[model samples]
Target: MNDFTFLLPTKFVFGRGVTDRVGAELAAAGYRHALVIYGQGSVIRTGTLDRVLATLDAEGIEHTELGGVRPNPEVGLVREGVALARECGADLVLAVGGGSVIDTAKAVAVGVPYEGDVWDLFAKRAKIVAEGKLPVTCVLTIPAAGSESSASCVISNDELKLKRGLSSELHRPVVAFMDPELAFTLPAYQIAAGVTDMIAHIMERYFSSVGPVPVTDNIACGIIHALVEEAPRALADPRDYDAQANIMWASTLAHNDIAGVGRNAVAGGRAGGWECHGLEHELSAHHTGITHGAGLAVVFPAWMRYVWRSAPERFLSFGRSVFGIEPVDAEADGVDVTPEEAVADAVTATIDELQAFFVSMGMPRTLGELGVTADDIPALLETLEQNKGAVFGDLQPLTMDDARAIYESCL
Candidate 1:
């Protein structure tokens, strides 16, 4: 195991009616003014926004509202939020939706106290200090991206056609109110995509170049297995509280650095293990219509096919333990297959199993299905270079050529 330090300071309040406690928590924390952030109109349509507003009003807490945060949240909205929060003299930022909303709130929290432009933080020109950020809390209505308890926040610059993620301990929400009931109305596509996104979170950390970190690996595998089992149940009945609860908690654990502990993600000065996220960020950055999880669904399997040769042992172990694949023995089974062939078969089977699961969840299987073609690959590569540079990943560092081939293979 590598040397690492892990810290998760967010107080996660999870249960059936925990959304009702948002106002009381803030009141107890002595936050008098808040900037409430949310997405388009889901919360409003479902009456969740009204309930939250009522609680804040009843608690005598003043609040300003900012809405219309789209998927792959934009820096423009974040800028607006910062201005609004500053104008209202908000000491707290309350996000009332899922990852995008929470991420925008996080960006606003850091941006409100900064002297420079907020995009500079995403661009790595500025650094975020914990003391400079406002307190942030959330009512999670979605289970993907894990921004509620995560140290990372992603925002897209519409004018520049770039999407960037900034990670700082200051980005973690001070509190997360996760009520599974809030997710009961989500569309099937959203549920599946959310599940895929959480799975990818663990896979990125689980596939590391650093030697054995048995504890983190076990945690990662267990979360993935639970998600794999519960995702279908959630899809079949969105009101399945147990399934939603498991998935919500799993998403939190997936990206909050718990599964990534003891791993050097910055090895070689590259964002080593999160290879597919780098690729999908380019896809969603170029085409705003694509969801983050949907893009991952298409890119992850193709990436596995491209890189499995570099670390067959990782794939084989994942196959047997996670998917319950039986160990292959040449002599015991009286088979003619060589050891290399057996390993190859297991790895291929693992990849196939993952692809089949995505397909079962109604995820697109190819870039073509997402309306991305050979013509789009050049622009994708351009942004990929801008965001991720010439190389990324530590398990099998990928050059620009490798990325292009992976893109082509997906199509």
Candidate 2:
């Protein structure tokens, strides 16, 4: 295991009716003014927005709101949020929706104190200081992206045709109210895509080249197993509280840097990076209409197909642990195969089964389903190169050619 430090400062108020605690938490923290941010109209439609606002009013906390945060959140709205928060003299950033909303709130929170444009942070031209960012809180209506507790925020710039992410410990929310019931009204497609995104978050850490960090590996696999098992239940019955609750908690744990600790080589630890996410970001960046999680569902299997050879043992272990695939199952009687070949067979079956799961959840396996054609591959690669550079991912250190091959395989 690589050396690591795990710090999760997000205080999660989870379970039924936890949404009511949003105001109390804010009051206790001495936040008098909030800049509420939400996506489209789901929260309002569900009366969740009214409930949250009522709580704030009961506590006498002043507030202003910015609505219309869409999936693959845009930076323009974030700039508006920063401006509105500044205009309202807001002291806290409160997001009342899912990942995209929370991500936008985080961007706005950091942007409020910075003099430069917020995209500059995503562009790596400016660094986020923990003390410089306003406190952020959440009323999570979705169980994916884990932005509530994660130090990461992803924002898209439509004009630049770029989708970029910025990570800082400061980006983590101060508090998150997770009531599974809040997600009951979500469409089946959003639920499936959310599950896929949460699972991919774990996989990004699980596939690292770190080590025999069996404890962390076990944690990652357990979350993946829980997500895989519970996602279907939630999809079948969105009102299934247990299933939704499991998925909701799993999403928070997946990206809070707990399962990822000692896996990523931050501060010169080891070899492992977010390879699939890097590739998927370009896909979503090019086609803004594509959902981030759906794009990931299309990209992850192809990435596994391309890079499993680079870390056969990791894939084999992942298959065995996450999918319960046995090496013996890959062996044929009277067929003397090399160990590498045996592992490869098991890994291939594992990847195929995973892709099958995505399909079963109504996810598109090909880029064409996402409206991405072979003609778009060049632009995708160019943006990928611009964002990720000539090489990325410590697992394999992928090049433009490798990325092109992965995109082609998705086709």
Candidate 3:
């Protein structure tokens, strides 16, 4: 068993219209001026931003709008926001959208204290360990990236197709205002992608060395159950509040370090192994890109096929418990499904179902479908190949060969 320790301090405020409480939460944090950070035009189209601004104004909070945070948020933007916050004397940050918004906000908060370019944090995070950051709060719109509660942010340096997560104990949001109703209008594909992301979170942690920690196992199982159970209901009817709430909580809980907490647990707890993340980051860097959720859809199954040999009974247990695919039947003298195949099939089925769900929801299902060409592949692979040797041993150790094979299979 690998040894470990854990600490998660993000305060979660959840419910329908719970986002309206951002003003109160920030007041409790003693912040008077803040910067409103969020993603593209959708937040405006949906009026989530308008409502958030109205609520903040009602609470008498002064703020500046730093709009135009993009998908695969750039380090340059984070640095720009830091400059904005400094010029305006903004003391706190309110991230009013999905994972990218929160991730971008976290990057800005950290950048405020740094003297150099923020890209330093993403490319080589060894410098500033932690400094005084403007406390951040989230009005999460997308549930896919658990970044609302996670302390890590994957920033892409636009000049290069390079992407890496800048992590520090300093980056977790002080508050995550997760209102399920806010997620009601989310497109069907986003809903599928969000649930897919949560399932990946659980699976990444579940593969930890099969220890006898009942709590960890139970938590992993519960997250898987909540995700698999609510995905269809949410997909069938986008505005189901109960299904939305169940999933919203599942997505947050998936990465809050509660599910896979135990000393020497199989999956790395303090820092979970993100084998698929390495593959998906480059996939997103290429083309208009697949949703992080959809990239995960391909990366995960292809990855399970790559790692099944490392842990057989664990994968078998996953198939049986999560997918309800039993390895053997009492009446069948016939050959039973092997754990490896069952787990792989279950994972692939999960991905394919998610892909079908993605198509139904107006999201891309394949890299080719996303317009990522063969020209993009070589540059993308080289981005991670150069870095894998440097960032080993979080969830699993990955060799360059392992990285290449996974990418080729994903293609």
Model 3, 1-411: lDDT tens digits are 355566678888888778777787777777889899988888899898998888778878899999898877877788889899999999888898888888899888888888878787676744654656788888988888788887577777767767777767677898888988888888887888888878777767776554445667777887887677788888888889898998888888887767767724443445346677777877776542457877877777777767766766666566666666544432373656765555566655644553454356454545666656556667776877755554443435777667766767666
Summing lDDT over every window of 10 consecutive residues in candidate 2, give the lowest-scoring window. Answer: 263-272
The clash count for each model shown is 1, 0, 4
Could you give candidate 1's per-residue lDDT for residues 259-295 as a string of tens digits? 8787665432212368999999999999999999999
**True-structure RMSD, every candidate:** 1.6, 1.7, 3.2
By TM-score, the candidates rank as 1, 2, 3
What would the per-residue lDDT of candidate 2 be over residues 193-279, giving only the tens digit for each residue?
Answer: 988998898888888877668888899899988888998998899999999999899989888877877776774332257889999
Residue 117, model 3, lDDT: 83
Off by over 4 Å in 1: 265-272
Work out candidate 1's RMSD over C-alphas: 1.6
If scored against the real structure, what TM-score would every candidate get? Answer: 0.97, 0.97, 0.89
Better of 2 and 3 by lDDT: 2
